[model samples]
Target chain A: MLTKRIIPCLDIKDGRTVKGINFVDLRDAGDPVELAEIYAKSGADELVFLDITATEQKRKTLAEMVRSVAEKVNIPFTVGGGISSIEDVDILLKNGADKVSVNSSAVKRPELINELSAKFGSQCITVAIDAKQVNGEWLVHLVGGKVPTDINLFQWAKEVEERGAGEILFTSMNNDGTKAGFANEALAVLSSELKIPIIASGGAGKIQHFTDVFLKGKADAALAASVFHFKEIEIKDLKEELRRNGVEVRL
Target chain B: MKIVIIDYGAGNIQSIKFAIKRLGFDAVLSSDAQEIKAADRVIFPGVGEAGSAMKMLKSTGLDKVIPELKQPVLGICLGMQLMCRHSEEGDTEGLGIFHADVVKFKTQLKVPQIGWNRIFNLKSELFEGIKEQEFVYLVHSYYVPECAETIASTEYGVEYTTAIQKDNFYGVQFHPEKSSDAGEKILENFLSSPSLLK
Candidate 1:
C-alpha cells in the first residue's frame, strides 16, 4: 500500500535555513543538514531542501550542504530553487536528493520537465506549483508567488502531469504563513484529477492540517515549513496522530 | 579498496558514485572491462529502458564480462532487472545470472509503481540490522517475481522481490543509494560482508 508522506521543507540560503514570512523576509533558522537530520530522525517521510536563493550566492553552498545532509541521514530528500537545467537536477539527485522539485525554472522552460523526465524518469522530477487564490480561483504563481502566471492552477497541473511529472507539490500562497490550514478545496480538486501523487504545501499550522489535507484534500503528502521548522509540531507525533485519525503511518 | 561502477550508458551513475562516497568509500565510474575486473566490487546501475541498456551493455562486450565477474557485483533497478533471466520491458533477454524473469506488475493501479513501499520476507544476510517490512524507496515499472534468490520481498499490489542474492551477485529492485540511511546500512553490510558461500 502507498503510505501518505509528511515532508518538511527548508528554504536554504547560503547553506543555512532561512524561513520567510510569505517568502519575503529571510531569517536564519539553523544549519540545513542538521535540521534535515533532525527531521529524518523524527520520521519525516521525506525532506525538501530548497536553495531558496540558489540563483545568487546560494549556488556554491548548495552542493556542500546537500553533501552534509546526505552524509547524516538515509531518507529521500529533494533540493529545489535555482535548478534551471537538467544538469542542475542531475547534480542535486547525485548529491543524495531523491527527487528534484522544480518551480520557477520549470515554469520558464516547460520542456525542461519533459527532458528531465525523459532522462531521469517522472519519478525523479517533481513540479512544485506555488498558487495563490486570486478572484476565488486558484492562480498559478511563479518566482516564489511574487509573479502570477496567466495559467490556471488546475490546467497547468494537468499539463505537467501529462508531461510525466511524477508528483505535484501544490502550495497555497494565501494561507502559506497564515497556518490556518491547507487549501483543501484546491488540493482535493487537483488530487482527484491527477493520477500522480499530489503533495499539499502551505497553510499547515497544526496536526489536524495534515489530516485535513489527507482526508479532506485527498493529498498523498502534506508539506509544512514553519510548523515543523519551528519545532512546534513534531513530525513523529503528527504521524501518530494521523494514524489514530485513520491514516496509514510507517510506525 | 575502490569500487568501480559500470556505466552502461543507462543509469544515474553520478548519484551512485555520490552515494558510495557518502558511505566513506571511493567509487570509480567505468565502462572499461579492465577497470571493472580490477575493482574491489562492480556496481551495475541502470535507469533507462531494458532493451536499450542491453544494447549498450553488449556494445562494450560488458554483458559477457559481467556474468563472468568473480568479484562481488551489485545491480540496482534496471541493473538488477538485467541480471535476471528475462525482462518484459522490451522483451530483452537478461544475463541469466539469477533464475528469474522481470515482468511488469499486471494490476490495474498503474504501469510504474513509483514512491516508497515496505519490504518484508528478508531471508539473507543482506538485511543485518534492518527489520522486516522496513520501508524502502522503490520506483520501478517491472518487477522480478518470486525466485529462489530473493533476499527481501516488498508488497505493492502483491508481494514482489525487493532484493535478491545469488552466489557472488546481488540485485535490488529498490535503489539502496536513494533509499536513505536504512538503505545505506544495507549497502555498508554488502561492502563489509562477503557472501556466505564465498
Candidate 2:
C-alpha cells in the first residue's frame, strides 16, 4: 500500500533556517542540514526547505545548503522559494536536491511550469499554489499570499497539472497561521479534480488535524512548519496516531 | 571496487553519488562507455521523458554498452523503466534488458503514484537484508507489469513489478537514494553482497 506522507517544512533565509526551532537535542537549531537529519531520523517521510532568502547570493547559498543537506540527510527533500528559472532548478538538482517547488514564478509565467517539467520531468517539478477563499471564490495569491489574482484556485491547479506539474502543493492562506484546521473542502475538491497528487499545506494544529487532512481533505501528503518545529506534535507519535485512525503511514 | 553511475544527461545523479558516498564508496558519473564498462558496478540512472532520455543514451552509445556489460548493473526509477522492452511514455522503446513493457497507470488512484510504498515477495539477493512490505519512495506514472524477471511487487491499483533482476542487471522502480534507511540498506546490499557478483 502507498502510505500517506508527513512532511516537515523549514524556512531558509540566506541558507540558514529561519524561525525558532524548539528541538532540545539540536546542537544548532538554525542549521537546516542538522535539522533535516534529525527530522529524517525522527520518522519524517519527506522534508521541504523553503528558501525565503532574497538576495543576489540567495541562489548560491541555497544551492550550497542543498548540497550539505543532501550529504547529511537520507530522505527526499524539496527546495522552494525564489526559484524562478531553469538555471536555478538545474543548480539545485545538480547539488542533489530531489525535487524543486515553484510558486509565484509559475503563476507569473505559466510557461515556466511547462518548461521545467519538459526539461526535468514532471516527477520533480512541484507547482505550489497559494490561495484564499473570498466570497465563495478561491482566488490564487502571489508573493507569499500577499497579492491576490482573479485566477480561480481550481482553474489554476488544473492548468498547472496540464502544464506537466507532477504534484500540487496547495497552501490555504486563510487557514495557515490559524491552526484551526485544514481547508479540507477545498483540498478534497482539488484532489478529485486533479490527477496529480495534492499536498495539503497551512492549517495543522493537532494530530486529529493531520488525520482529518488525510481522511477528510484526501491529501496525499500533509506539510507543516511550526507544529513539528516547536515539538507540539512529534512525528513518531503523530504517525502512530495516524495509523490508529486507519491512515496508512510509513512507521 | 570502482563504481560508475552512467550519466547520459538524464536527471539527478548527484543524490545517487551522495548515497554511495554515505556508504563509504565513491562513484563517478560518466557517459563514457569505457569508464562504465571498466567499473565493477554500474548504476544507470534516468529521471526525465523516456524518449529524450533514450535519445541521450543512444547519442552516447550507452544504449548498446549497458546490456553488454558483465558487471552488476543497477537501474533506478526511470532507469528501471528504460530497461524494459518498451514504454508507453513518449511511445519510446527501451534498452530491452528486462523483457517487459512499461505502461502507464490506468487506475483511479493517481497518475504519478508518489510517496512511500511497500515492496513484497522479495526474491532477489538485492533485497538481502530488506524485509518484505518495507516502504520505499516512488514517483512514476508508468510501471512494468509482473513478468518473469520480477523479484518484488508493489500494489497501487494493480500489482506491478517494483523490482526486477535478470542475470547481472538489477532494476528498482523506487528511488533507493531517497528512500531513507531501509533504502540505504538495499543499496548497501547491492554494493557489498558477494553473491550478487557474476
Candidate 3:
C-alpha cells in the first residue's frame, strides 16, 4: 500500500535555515543538512527545502546546501523557490536533489513546465500553486502569495498536470498561518480533478489536522513548517495517531 | 570492490553515488564500456523516458555492454524497467534481461504513484534483513507485473513486482537511495554481499 507521506518543509536562506527551529539536540539549528537528517531519522517520509534567498549567489548557496543535505540525509528531498530555468534544476539534480518544485516561474512562463518535464521526466518535476479565495473565486497568487493573478487555481493546476508535472503542491494562502486546518474542500477538488499527486500545504496545527488533510483533503502528502519545527507535534507520535485513525503511514 | 554507476545521462545518478558513500563505499560515474565492465559491481540507473534513455545507452554502446556483463548488476527505477523485455513508456523495447514487460498503471489511482509503499513476499538476498511489508519510496508511472523472476511485490491498486532477480542481474522498482534506513540497508546488502551474485 502507498502510505500518505508526512513532510517537514524547511525554509532555506543564503544556504542556511532561516526559520526558528526548536530542535534542542540539533548541534546547529541553522544547518539545513543536520535538520534534514533529524527529520529523516524521526520518520519524515520526505523533506522539502524552500530556498527563500534573494541574492546573486543564491543558486550557488542553495546548490551547496543541497549537496550537503544529500550527502547526509538518506530520504528523498525536493528543492524549490527561485528555480526558474533548466540549468538551475539541472545543477540542483546533479548535486543530488531528487525533485525540484517550480512556482512563480511556471506561472510566468507555463511553457517552462513543459520544457522541464520533457527534459527531466515528469517524475521529478513538481508544480507548486499558491492560491486564495477572492470574491468566491480561487485566484492564483505569485511572489509568495503577495501578488494575485486572474488565473484560476483549478485551471492552472489542471494545465500543470496536462503539461507533465508529476505532482502538485497546493498552498492555500487563506489557511497558511492560521493553524486552524487545511482547505480540505479546495484540496479534495484538486485531488479528484488531477491524475498526479496533490500535496496539501499550510494550516496544519495539530495531528488531527494532518489526519484531516489525508482523510478529508485526499492529499497524497501533507507539508507543514512551524508545527514540526517548533516541536508542537512530533512526527512519530503523529504517525502513530494517524495509524490509529486508520490512515496508512510509513511507521 | 570497484563500483561503477553506468551514467549515460538519463537521470539523477548523484543521489545513488551519495547513497553508496553513506554506506562507506565509493562509486564512480562512467559511460565508458571498459570502465563499467572492469568494475566488480555495476549500478544501472535511469530516471527519464525509456526510449530516450535506451537511445543514450546505445549511443555509448552501453545498451549492448550491460546485458553481457558477468558482474552483479543492480537496476533501479527506470533502470529496472529497461532491464525487462519491453516498456509501455515511449513504446520502448528494453534490454531483455528479465522476461517481464513494463506497463503503465491503469487503475483509478494517481498516474505516477509517489511516496512510501510496502514491499512484500521478499525472495532475494537483496532484502535479506528487510521485513515483509516494509516501506520503500517509489515514483513512477510504469511497473513490471508479477513474473517468475519477481523477488518482491508491492500494491498500488494492483499487485506488481517491486524487485526482480535472474542469475547475475537484480532490479528494484523503488529508489533505495531515497528510501531512508531500510533503503540504505538494501544498498549495503547489494554492495557487501557476494551471495547476491550466486
Candidate 4:
C-alpha cells in the first residue's frame, strides 16, 4: 500500500520564497535549491513549488528556479501558478518538474486538464482547487481565492476526476492563512467521493493536523508551509507524531 | 578517478549524485564518449519513455559507448529496463544487454506500484551483506519478468525480477539511491566489487 505523503509547498517569488517574520532558518530558506535539499533531508514525502509571483517575465525565471531545486532534490515535485497550456506543462516537466498543477487556468478553461492529461498520463496532471466556506457550504474559489465560483466543491472535484486529473490538491482558503487545522469535514466528503488520491492543503498549525487529515479526512497526503518554513514544526518530529497516531507514514 | 554517469537523456540525475556522495564516491554526469571511456565506472540512469530514451541514447551515441565500457557499469530503474531486450512502455525497443522484455505489471493492484516492496530470491555478490526477503523501495509500472540474469525478485501483484546481473553489467529495478541502507550497501558493493573493474 502507498503510504501517506507529507508535502511542504514553497511559494517562490523572484527566485526567493517569502515567509513572514524572517529568521535564520527562513532567511536562507528563501534560496529554492537550498530549501529543497533541506526538506528532502527532513523527510518530506514530496514538494510543491507554487509560482505565485506570476508575470509575463517571471515564467522563464520560474523554470530556472525549478531546475535549481530539481538539482538538489530527487523526490517528486509539483509546480503550479501561471501555467495555462500544454506547452507550459511540457517545458516544466522537461526541465525536471514531475507534475504540473493547474488552478486558475483550469477554472477558466477546464479542458486544459483533459488535454494535458491526454498527452501526458493522468499521473502527470494535478488539479488544485481553492475552496472556502460560504454560509455553511464550501464553495470553490479561483485566482488565488479572490473570486468565487458557482460550482460546488464536491461537484467540481468529481468533475476534475472525470477530466483525467491524477490527483486533486484541495486547499481550504478560510484556513489558508490561519493555520488552525485542515478542514477535515470538507476533506472527508471529497475523499469519499473521488477515486484519485487527494492531497489536503491549508490550515496546518501543528503536526497533528496532518495525522488528522490522513486518519479522519482520508487524505492521501497533508501539505503545509509556514510551520515548516519558520521551523515551527520539524518534519521528522511531525512524522513521529503521525506514526504515534497510527497513520502509516514513511519516516 | 571521476565516475561517469551516462546521460542518455532519461530522468533526473541529482538523486544518483546525492546517493554517490553520501557513499563517499565522486560521480560525473556525461554522455560524451571520450569522458565515459576514461572513467573508472559508468552509471546509466533513465526514467521516461523507453523507446525515446533509447532513441536519445542512440542520438547521443551513448548507446554504442555504454555497452562497450571496460569499467563496472550499473543501471537504475528505467536505466535497467532500457538495458534489457525490450519494454512494454511506449512500445519501445531496448538495448539487448539482458535477454528479457520489460512487461507491464498486471493491473491487479495499481498501474504504478509506487511504494516500498520486498525483494526475495536474492543471488550474487550484490546481496553479499543483504539478507533474503529484505524490503527495497520501488515505483515502477513495468518490470522485467524473471530471467536467467535475475539477481533479486520481488512481487507486487505477481513475482517479477527486481534486479539483474550479467558480467560487468548490473541492473536494479528499485532505486538504490532512494532505498536507504540496503541501497547504500548495494551501491558500495558495486563500487568495491573487484571483478567488474576488469
Interface RMSD of each: 2.8, 0.7, 0.6, 4.0
Per DockQ, the best of the predicted structures is 3
DockQ of each: 0.43, 0.90, 0.92, 0.21
- Model 1 TM-score, 2 decimals: 0.89
Tens digit per residue, CA lDDT, model 2, A1-251 = 89999999999999899989998998998999999999999999999999988799988899999999999888999999989999999999999998999999999999999999999999999999999999999999999999999999999999999999999999999999998889999999999999999999999999999999999999999999999999999999999999999999999
For each candidate, the alpha-carbon lDDT, in order, equals: 0.81, 0.94, 0.94, 0.80
* CA deviation > 4 Å runs, candidate 1: A20-29, A54-58, B9-11, B14-24, B90-93, B106-112
True-contact fraction for model 4?
A: 0.07
Encode model 1's per-residue lDDT on A83-147: one tens digit a residue. Answer: 88977776776665667889887788888888988877777788999998888888889888999
Please, what are the lDDT tens digits per residue for candidate 3 over residues B1-198?
A: 899999899899999999999899999999998998899889999998999999998888888999998989999999999999999988999999999999999999998999999999999889989999999999999999999999999999999999999999999999999999999999999998868643
Off by over 4 Å in 3: none
lDDT of 3 by residue, A44-153 (tens): 99999999999999999999999998899999999999899999999999999999999999999999999999999999999999999999899999999999999999
In candidate 3, the residue pairs with backbone N, CA or C atoms under 3 Å apart (3 or more residues apart, or in different chains) clash, namely none
Give me the TM-scores for chain A across all models, comma-separated. Answer: 0.92, 0.99, 0.99, 0.96
Alpha carbon lDDT of residue A166, candidate 2?
98
**Residue B136 miss distance in model 4 (angstroms):** 6.9
What is the per-residue lDDT of model 2 for residues B41-93, given as tens digits with 9 covering 90 to 100?
99988898999999988887888999999999999999999999999999999
lDDT of 3 at A202: 92
